[model samples]
Target: MKSQEVIFVGTRSGLRLVLDAEENIENLKRVLERRLQEAVGFYSGARVTVETRGAVVAPEWIEEVRSVLAHHGLSMDERGWDGASAGSADGGASAGREPEAPPDGAGQDQSLPGADTVLIRRSLRSGQSVSFDGNIVVMGDVNPGSEVCAAGDIVVFGALRGVAYAGANGSADARVIALRLTPTQLRIADKITRSPDDEVQAPSGPEMAYLRDGAIVIEPWTTHLGAVFGV
Candidate 1:
């Protein structure tokens, strides 16, 4: 089995995925499919960048690779091609280039009706803070001392060790979901809760926190509650 690793390359648009050059294309596709399967909710409507670090390749190969990604509803942006000369046969100098930003107000938000969902693909280290007006879905861990606040729900694919506040704008229906729910402080709407000092050590699993009666209550996530919770 091939171990999948994620490398972040910060850019103007957003973070880019740096795929290993040595890995075969099949393995790359498999890794991407697995990641999508694991975090379907996070990637449902997210835009991603698939970056490379070599000269531009054949157009057919690029199209084929892109088709594979499209099957999973993932968009791709090619970048990092500085080796080929201007007149090289590798399809001109603009083969693998970053896309220019859209014109002002072309794609900007305009009082959208649906709530925005921010998908974070990297870990939140100590001292890092994320604040958004809508829901937040983090695909990585939230380390201690970090803070995440959203006006809607909060979903952490990994461990939650920091402080998280869902429904910060007073939406009592918002909830917090995490794979490992041992947070220093957790809040839903106006209710707040903290992990007990003598916390019981147990296997980590999916859990959810929501407002119950007048207080926040945590419970294990189950598929059977899908209809009741409207999840």
Candidate 2:
């Protein structure tokens, strides 16, 4: 059989399936089924993420793809849908889903490795999406309608109005942090949260997001918290 073009990119973090945004929804469904069957068992129980690469996909189409993957015992990981941390804060990970803020002056976050860093120097407007297999640091604002997804942590030096995902590969320990954190949605590993409809206020400073009791929680950030996040 001939190989499929622009299929999937497998990275250390997980599998990034380059979904065809241009194809008709039904046709795309058939193609995805066939392609997944061909590569079945090879990625047994692996974490999978679908990327349209600028193509628009309806939620129904995505559900169809997820159905196919589920048939192959591959579950869809929606944690990093341009998400960060456990909530809308620092992009880091946890074990017991307990808040793991650095205990006051614990020095550097020995857990953060230097290898997982992706730096974006520009602002991200709506409809723009950035995905990486590591941590994401945006030097500019992440405007509403934009999204950022990563397998590790996420840190935005400016406003973070978009969605952010951290630990997309199933590591609950991941966290998300932003200078001005008013995100549309936030995710860390398997947990996700959005701001309440009645809460229209924004934090005056930076914020961190992490897991707390199996849920994502966003917190006001302090210098000590920065040190724990290795900021």
Candidate 3:
């Protein structure tokens, strides 16, 4: 396979593997393994989707790719099975379905066994993105057009104006917290929501967004709420 045989694009949903059309199956595996090995630890725990350059990808080939991804601790997203492209080479949105209502007080404890927490000390600019297997804590703003995704919760000490996806691995209990809660889009697990289109009042204080009654809801972050996320 050539160097351009496989392309990796990060988006609000997760990571996408855009494969070239007419790629030799064996060569495809080799390139995929090599690329994944190069970023070994960084890609673990991220949900992945595969897309071809307008070619019909066989199920067996997809499963082979899935096996390779699993070896690297990544799982495949089924949405791409129908050959729907998640994003272009630059990356964009591929929204998931809204989740059913979760039980009361779900995800309140917000603890994950053996899940590592990554701290990003710098703000994320447009066209930048970060994805992790566990939780994420960003010390600065997430500017518009940027994205932050984790399999667990996300806590931003500054503004979140871009896209933020918590529980990217299907954990509906995950929450997103920011000093300024506005965002282009917000996703928790399989559920998705966005900021209202109408003008809104300024954020009075820190805010938290989470799944409630099968929809995403935002509330003021209080002193007690800090204990829930262990901030």
**Cα RMSD to native, each candidate?**
15.5, 15.5, 13.1
User: Each candidate's TM vs. the true structure?
Assistant: 0.51, 0.54, 0.56
Off by over 4 Å in 1: 1-114
Model 2: how far is 182 from its true place, Å?
0.5
Q: Estimate every model's Cα lDDT from 0 to 1.
A: 0.63, 0.68, 0.75
Per-residue lDDT of candidate 3, residues 52-156 (tens digit)? 654555668888889999999888867555433324222212222211211112223323511689999999999999987788999999999999988878999
Candidate 2: where is the Cα deviation over 4 Å? Answer: 1-114, 228-231
- Best candidate (score: TM-score): 3
Q: What's the true lDDT of residue 57 in model 2?
A: 52
Model 2 lDDT vs. the true structure? 0.68
**Total clashing pairs for each candidate:** 0, 30, 0
Per-residue alpha-carbon lDDT of candidate 1 for residues 1-231, written as tens digits (9 for 90 to 100): 646443333222332455554466677667766765774433332234544433344566456556765776655544322222222344232323432332122224422211689999999999998977678999999999998887678999999899998776456778888889889999765577987888578535888889989698888877765458887
